[model samples]
Target: MATEERNHVSNGEGDREEQEDEKMEQFFALLRSFREARDKRKHELRLRDHEEDINKKMKKSKASKLGNDERSSWVPRFEWEDFTSEFEFPRPLVVFPTPYNKKEDQKNQEDDDGLDLNLTLSSASL
Candidate 1:
């Protein structure tokens, strides 16, 4: 009887170990699958972003080319020598007379040399 009991216990332990092995394998497979799905999603997002950037750049380049063509036609050519030959610039007319301050002139002349005024008259008839 004891021998049969011992055999039964060993069989149960073996069955438990097999079940644990299957659980561990299932856990590892789920982890690998989740990581793969996350990486694929990130890759898809990056590709879409790059595609959008390329489209924006293409649009800007096309607009710049069209603008350049339109701007070149509107530019005016300047011939300065032809205008100067036909039109003569006259001198501007003087509106106000040049300011003449007698006080400042006298002050400048007094600073030049010795100049004295003699204003004395003899008392003839009072």
Candidate 2:
């Protein structure tokens, strides 16, 4: 009888140890899963912050470029007299000669003769 009681107690203790080990394993698994979830959330938040920062910088850069373009497009008004007064005569002027046409040449000669006749008549009246 004593040996049977001892065997029964040993069996109960073994069963209790197995149950405790299973509970400890479940707790450790739950803790690991929680930590992983927390880490994932932190990583996502950091990524979101970085994207927001980039978007802000892009907006600022675009705004600055637009402002520069607007500034460059502005033209200051000046008076016609001011422009004429600032002109320097006898400066090298680049002229592009068009292809000569006979009809145009004849018309120009006639215009010059008419001007000469007008000048003679004006001088006689003077």
Candidate 3:
């Protein structure tokens, strides 16, 4: 009877140990899930912050490029000058050369006309 009691006690202890081990495993699984969730939340927050920072930088860059303020606006210089009657006109920038030989050009025109007349007469005779 004593031996049976010892065996029963050892079996109970074994069962308790198994229950404790199962509980520890469940706790560790919950801890791992919580850690994963925390890491995911942190990553999402970081992405949101990075996106917001990029949007801010883009807005600033676009504002600078477009010159949204009056101080950054460009103004062209357009001053009117009053000219007096005594103001002399400037000389022409480009000068063309006169004909060098007008007689030679006239002789060439006469020779072309003679050639045309001869062609016409030869074609009529043919």
Candidate 4:
């Protein structure tokens, strides 16, 4: 009876050790799963942030293109004097030659000559 009781106690201890090992394995599995989930969440958040950045850049590029297109089609009906008076500085001028027409060419020539005479007279006076 004494030997039998010793055998039973040893068997119980073995069973307890097996149970403890299984519990440890289960705990490790749970930890691994949690880490994987956390990493996945971080990856998703990074992708979302990159997508938002791309969207903002696209919007800015589209707006700039629209502005450039508007400027390209813009026609100024105001005179140089009106522009200069508003800006209050020596503004760079862009001259667009009118289509070939006899009267227009003659008028442009006369204007050029008048401008030259004005400059010469002003320099002489100074």
State the C-alpha lDDT per candidate.
Answer: 0.85, 0.89, 0.84, 0.86
Task: Give each model a TM-score.
Answer: 0.50, 0.51, 0.52, 0.50
Model 1 regions lying over 4 Å from their true place: 69-126
lDDT by residue (1-126, candidate 3, tens digit) is 999999999999999999999999999999999999999999999999999999999998887777556353568675455443466659856778877798998887875665553435565366
Predicted structure 1, TM vs. truth: 0.50
Error of 3 at 75 (Å): 16
Write down the RMSD of candidate 4 (Cα, Å): 20.0
Candidate 4: minimum summed lDDT over ten consecutive residues — where? 115-124
lDDT tens string, model 2, 15-53?
A: 999999999999999999999999999999999999999
Clashes of each: 0, 0, 0, 0
Off by over 4 Å in 3: 68-126
> Considering every candidate listed, which one attains the maximal lDDT?
2
lDDT of 1: 0.85
Q: In model 2, which runs have C-alpha deviations exceeding 4 angstroms? A: 69-126
lDDT of 4 by residue, 1-126 (tens): 999999999999999999999999999999999999999999999999999999999999998988786666656588678757755458768889767999987997975665453435565366
Candidate no. 2 TM-score:
0.51
